[model samples]
Target: MDDLEKAETVLQALKTAEQQPPQAALPILNGLAGLVQGDPDAPLEVQEVRADVFMAICELGKALHRGQPAEALWAPALTAAKRWRGLLG
Candidate 1:
């Protein structure tokens, strides 16, 4: 899949993980960890998008830690991440 698609997939996985307990989500989170680190073969723009995605994921994590319910945080996080992805596009 293309980088934006890949990034979206990763974000979706993150959202799913957010809905579950942290221990249950660890595998999905770990699976997605590398894509945002930017592979050497990927375009710079894709790398930048991945970085934005990573940041958004971090924000979501922080929100979760701060006791924000998944229901409340998911939409805003997804919206922000999509906006960042569009900018990268």
Candidate 2:
């Protein structure tokens, strides 16, 4: 598939993975990182959104893995996902 198509596929995977319990977020975040890294042809907004999503995912994963409350990470993830949706639109 083309880069854009691949990126969209990754993003959809992220979205689906985010809906699951915190235990499932890390692998999906790693997948997103692989999809976006070094892909300079992607739109600036898309790249930014993906980066935000990646960081948010990392934070959530860290929090969950460290035994912190999921709610502490949930807001940022939701915000990042909303921003990603806006960028996609």
lDDT of 2 by residue, 1-89 (tens): 55555556655776676687767765665666665453567688777877876787777667767767766666676576666656655
Looking at model 1, the pairs that clash are: none
* lDDT agreement of model 1 with the native: 0.64
Q: Using lDDT as the measure, which candidate wins?
A: 2
lDDT of 1 by residue, 43-70 (tens): 6655566676676667666655665654
| Residue 22 of model 1, lDDT score | 61
Deviation of model 2 at 86, angstroms = 2.0
Cα TM-score per model: 0.54, 0.60
Full-model lDDT for every candidate:
0.64, 0.66
